[model samples]
Target chain A: MTSNSPVGQDFWDELRRTTQARIGLGRTGTALPTRRVLELAGAHAAARDAVHIPLDVERLAAQVREIGIGEPVLATSRASSRDEYLRRPDLGRQPAPGTDIPESGADIGLVLADGLSPTALDRHGAALLAELVSWLRDRYTLAPPIIATQARVGLGDHLGAAARVRTLLVIIGERPGLSVSDSLGIYLTHLPRPGRTDADRNCISNIHPPDGLGYARAAQVAAGLVEGARALGRSGVDLKDRSRTEALGPPSGSEPGIQPGHSPRRR
Target chain B: MIHRQQVSGVTYAFDGLVEVMAKATPLRSGDQLAGCAAESDGERAAAGWVLADLPLEVFLNEEIVPYDTDEVTRLIIDGHDRSAFSAISHLTVGGLRDWLMEMAAHDHGAEHLAAVAPGLTPEMVAAVSKIMRNQDLIAVSAAVQVTTAFRTTIGTHGTLATRLQPNHPTDDPRGIAAAVLDGLLLGCGDAVIGINPATDSPQATADLLHLLDAIRTRYDIPAQSCVLSHITTTLGLVEAGAPVDLVFQSIAGTEGANAAFGVNLQLLREGNEAVRSLGRGTVGDNVMYLETGQGSALSSGTHLGVGGAPVDQQTLETRAYAVARDLRPLLVNTVVGFIGPEYLYDGKQIIRAGLEDHFCGKLLGLPMGVDVCYTNHAEADQNDMDSLLTLLAAARVPFVIAVPGADDVMLGYQSLSFHDVLTTRRTLGLRPAPEFDAWLRRVGIVDDAGRLTPFDPTTSPLRSLASAVAP
Candidate 1:
């Protein structure tokens, strides 16, 4: 109907009215004031105030290299233009020719991608990386993190294959939103390679300032995923099943005694 | 000591030492002893303390009867039908339409179908089978065509062509036609966005329009819902001095070298603006397809090749945000995004990386941008309805279901309707209304008899109709 119609005038209105009422009634008097107080305190501060210095990509890449880190491989796609990139994904998976990769396998392969949110990378990439590296160090003998630039999600697989790492983690920026779009996401794969499907990867997303999956937790989850992948041989559903079964007890019996004509199945 | 006495047919026993035992003994009943034993068995079962006396085979086989022939049959039939239906559905809309072209050729004797359908000769039986398949496809295609037409007729249409295909790796013509119709409806009585066939062939455009018209007529779309004469294009703005008041473009592919953001933006800003100045719309009101552009960045770098650099997360987010923000002010009533590849790096990351990160995060982050964020190319095979409904519920926004292949619209519609029924009731904790006026508004349906009355569920003629349909 017309846009001018009031709520409750039609089925959609009724639905909206009911939903709004439910949300309103359910969340009543449960609002937190701490966030508002913190927001007010941080209002005058610059977006970059949290960090001591601005990030220098070239310098960071060099430093990562000079620290005797693994060889830095550059990720580029044959879809040299945007139109081709959108239409052709096969091109985005392969890396450019002549990019250097370490002769021996590294402990971890670090890939920095623009992902959907490039601007977000400038804000959350460092903290996410730092947290990730620290967490990795705590758990395993970490080879220096090899930061691959201008990479895609699939590029991580290629880099991982080239580096021969047990796990490849790509910390890319998430697309910005009105509230907190500058979030970072971590995508990890065990035994990464080209043509690797999404089922082989796991991600910890929304790593940003507020209302996000924080770096420490994300790192822990990533580490846990790596360890689980090492044991389980893959990520995504495989790792999820392992983690879930570990958290809860395993199945008591082969048959769960689930019977036919049960309401549980019907529902 | 006991003594037995016989009285008629009954025998009674009495103890000689009864008087001596009465002071020292208590009465016991057989029924009470039996009840105690049963209670002990129940406790043992509850505690899973199996007794050695019980046979394992009894627990394994006798206690459990897993087979339910009725359920198994139903499941098998349902599964078969679903699979067949899905295949048929895809064929009818996407493949059937393509087949229609082949059929026309066959009718003209350009090609033979013996290669595709080997066993079936040009006999009547094979012909009937082919016809039946076509009919099934047509039936499903009609349902999809009708629903889309009805939605478009009411004016709540969004980008339809830009969605991903379910079976194939490309867009479906039927789906695109439906979307084009929807766009035309939204742009009714005003100029709106349109797609120029990438091939740029006049015959292709004509054929597309003809097919669209045939589908519309076959489905009996209302005469008032007329198809536009020309497919509107961004290029058209340049030719016409009367450039549209505004243009909204999505920055999805801006990050990768392959995206069209740079060229598109340059054209819109420099070329289109040079022809005529157009103001950008605010975030919530803007209408465009920016979701795919931004979402693509997840898997691929930016259109400008800036993605691979060691940019900090903030910088990346800000740049993406800037793209969305810049496009936000220029958006119109409809904004669409890709939920499949662009927003989601992969299918499994729905909560963390997919919906949460790209779709909701990016759209919501845009300053007052996107009245409705369309999630295109959703996983139709899975029970993604809940995920989609949950995301929408969380965001408190309206959405459209985009399924691949034209014939699968019915399945999509059924899934959406089911989801709406379950989620609306569960989340809102309310009874179904006579009419979902808010849904109509979101989709843009209006009652013409009531002076172009907007159909608000709270107070609309359609309310009674919707109420009648409510389960």
Candidate 2:
């Protein structure tokens, strides 16, 4: 961002190109430059607001239908409000009567929840859901998407169990950092049910426009995991993302896992 | 009889709670440790006699007048002298007109008694501690600091130490490494040098651990490091063999608060087991770190419905006892000022709340410390922290956090600084934990007189790279 300046700013431009991280920003005597401060303040505001603002589940459901992902059945978690959800994560992780998660018979449960950042869903939920439909709509029967408000990763488990879906694909908004408030995340669980621990699911984080896991890549990853989970009869640490790994290039010969050795993302 | 047990010149509580206590686990390791279970059994038998014989007033409400209270009082009337506590406990709260007049002559005795009484409430501790001399305050309290395989307590088992929490703006190892370097150069890290990395992913946590591991190993510093994030994250890291000395989590005083955090006793048990399996504990079998503050409970609306619900912050904090009573922690920090003046308005209020949390946590039989801090928006300054820090030290708090430059860039708050630690140690004639102190001396950071020498960061292995990467 600083590279567009005229005062010999080539170094900062180089750094910016190499990493989206806020490095090489010139400072003003013991403090950050004013523009950087303003940008950060704006970003922080977005993150905080994202946590508090309630997502319009009806509008989200309509958007999903418009995108032809299928008509989503709007639902609410046990947490009725943003404050309650923030206070009680377990409530958000449960499927009570309010969520309207229909009981019985579906090959897969699809949940689109306004998680830690509702803004993330507003930005990328429809796109990702549409992408998932393009890939797996014919292969598996997706129960009407349950538009969840105030939800957590575990909410997917509850939704799937409520619908008796064999597998689940839940898209959620991850907790926003000082920057990057709209990062989307996907959690896939096989044999989805309540009381399914974190180890019973797989996580693919940081899906957003530009500078993140692209929807295509995220779909590829999710599809691979789902296929693996159905074959192995489970998800999470037990199942590897080896399918995606092989697709990415030369086989790493390891299970699907986080690659901490090299991948860099702005926290 | 006013029965009691004393070990290593420290008096142990063998009263009401002990009656229900399964067995005592040695909280810290160092000098002579008389088996807690043996004494606990003895106390349990004595309590059994009293429970069966003593007619007690039982309330359906939370408050119950323990038979031990009357038994202890009866012994005092019968001329028991093992503790001035017998004399102090039976006192009416009629202020100067009541017990203070008669107890003035037993000032020294009461102060000592109060320090070692494990079950004394914060208000009671404050009252007794208020009457003692500053010099007496230090002497009576446990001055012994406990250390884990990688971490150390600042003072004695009951006294205070700072848990240096150097959080990075991001979970960037580079940023955290710089901040930690700053704190270390100033002779902080008396409490375990831990970081609160912003990144929630387990891989990033592993990176932070591996980075600190390399730094500490290269310097041979006597400190353990942890990314003071969620216990689940730390649990995963521990399972992965990342260098974790303490598993950290935020717990509240009520079941609702714990639920809000998605935590329950079962999860804590699992986490404790995860840390225990490491077997890297240096301080006896104790190996847990829990954090609790007030707003969390109130925000959950748990405080509104119950008849005796925690209406105030102090009462709200005590609810944490319900959670802590199950999982025994090696270190617990009552992050007082971090709540800001709204909950605890101004310096005086902050000081009182800090003491109350410390007192309450200690009364519940956990090794406790106070995190002396304040947010930027709070109507507090360094002067307030200085006063609170000194009082906490005088109270012999288990630990306090010594941040780099006293400011946490990531958390956006000001807390105790590395300079503060040095100043507190030098002025109070206090030192870091024994092993940590030895490490400090061995590294020539402090002299034989326990005075800090001039620190030259240029000499550090990280200096060259840090300077190269300096923003």
Candidate 3:
């Protein structure tokens, strides 16, 4: 290659080390280097393959049961197959006929769903639930965790309404990205029901281990959101996650609307 | 409104214009899911036949979504340019298709198409598109020229722009900085360096804004920056005197859908005015970057039409262009496959939707781009994106979103990578926006021939930026 490039190898290398994003790969005439090209294809193939991987529901339930919060209930959405689940999102939000979920009237309902990426749920679902349970078990009443297959985020609403819980936390496998296939997401809805829209829920996404949001931090944020939803009688847009602010301490200067410990308010 | 037709001795009757339009739409999973798609190919052909004979003026008289209830319908009616309409007002939908194709073949066709753009409604343009092929969509879209500018002029002929989407999973400045640097080296960001912040909080949005602004200022990049937050959150940042370049919002076709997004025409107008008043542009003042997708209305349950029938996603998607046109935005992009298989299904549908969106936006006189992307769950891969990217490049789309390695970790989708943009530009003999093209040469990132130059990163001029944001 000609010595006509302006980028320094050391600075570019250092920057690449800071992020998972592909950077500083030398190009071959407007094309990616051969290794990088194959790496991308392989990553994409892996991510796509991960989407079709079925969650080991039985193993997952056993792992969650070991957490000792509550018994695990198995369920399936109206979508009977993986192909149907991908094509019909509406079907994935409704419970299959005669699911028989108990209306326990618990304060919190937890649902673990094999969303677009069952591989994500298979990998981190139990560990994240354990962390979240550690934070909530002492202060709140918990219901049996529902492990749903062929499910979407909205399935939690139906499950929550059936369970008669005050707050529903749906821990779902997010759509797999090329770089991170096993990332999990949490959606918290206050008084979740059959018709609750996304605006009625608050999301904490990118929950994976080692690189993405760690289990402890994600659990801390989920717990804080639950507290806010409980205090305000709502979730979603009305509730903002201030746990990061609390951890970082109050801003140096007194800015207007910067209440240190005030309850959640409507936007 | 003549909603019935006969084909192969089979008669098909539609209830109204909305039904005809919906049933006429080319096969897409969204229309099927909306319960408005024609029951069979024969039925679809009949609807197309009926739609073809319908006069362009019929669109002016019949409201698909009732004008009284839909602000989008009202905007289309209230903003109709009578003088412009007179030129092609007599043509039927089929005549418009012929007229557009004929115009595309002529050298002065671009000017004629641009002149008639204001006269067209989203419905009329969409109607013509339904009867046209993917090649026809590309030909007509290529003939029309819609240009806008902020720091760099986009949509100029022979130039393709890219929005450098350097998104971070946590809105971390360092992670974002690395991606931005990577994009810049690959000749991206001519359209804008826009970030979709993981959090919608004003504080996080403001911080990302400052980070982008500092990089732009230090590098003197010939590009604009946007933190793609809700219009309300962005307006608040503008009020707080952040370096707001482009006000970004994800808009839909109907008032109710916009409401679900917590925005209205009035709010968008306010955001446009606020960003324009900032006088932040070095080259031009068109400073709004809007994103639209096919299934947003249906996704939000706001896709209802005349007689409560669900309008097709494509028609509603084209209607969103009117919203973008009203704001005189710097850029408008359809995230074609981003909504997944629920709307577009596999690669073929996505490619077709991408073309239709570009064609309609161009016909409606808006600088249009596409985020040629898809989710992993959508039965699509990089090969699919390659097809769409190549097709859009052939169509001369104003811009496309290019992220690092074609992966948006925050958004969880695959878009065109920086190398993809580079390859597309090289393949089509295209260059970036003029200002950015000049800056690339000035900064020695590329030679005068627009070819990349190898250099030591330690001595690179962008080292300062890397050092500033390095953790």
Top model number, lDDT: 3
Candidate 3 stretches with Cα past 4 Å from truth are A1-9, A61-72, A103-108, A129-144, A164-167, A189-192, A199-204, A213-267, B469-471
lDDT of each: 0.35, 0.58, 0.87
Report the lDDT tens digits of candidate 2 across residue range B1-471.
233444445544443322212122111110001112324445434333332222211111122112233221221123222243443444432231123333333545344434434333322333333233344334433332223333554445332345666675455555555566555544566667777665566876777778777777777776766677688888878877788777778777555566777777678889988887787655445567777774555545544322232333344465464355456677777777665333544566566566656655554455667778765324456678888788777656777887655555455556776666667766777776666667767776667767655534345454643333423
Segments of candidate 2 deviating more than 4 angstroms: A1-44, A90-104, A154-158, A194-199, A209-211, A244-267, B1-110, B113-162, B166-176, B185-188, B195-331, B334-356, B362-367, B370-398, B402-462, B465-471
lDDT of 2 at B434: 63
Report residue B362 deviation for candidate 1 (angstroms): 35
Top of the candidates by DockQ:
3
lDDT of 2 at A257: 21
Candidate achieving higher lDDT, 2 or 3: 3
Residue B191 displacement (Å), model 1: 25
> Candidate 3: what lDDT?
0.87
Docking class of 3: acceptable
Best-fitting candidate, scored by TM-score: 3
Candidate 1 per-residue lDDT, tens place, B148-260, comes to 11122111222111121111101234334433332222211111222223232333434433443443344333221111112233335324432232333433323332242
lDDT by residue for model 1 (A84-133), tens: 34334455566667666663465667776655445566666656777777
DockQ of each: 0.03, 0.03, 0.39
Residue B187 lDDT in candidate 3: 90
Which candidate do you rate higher for TM-score, 1 or 2?
Answer: 2
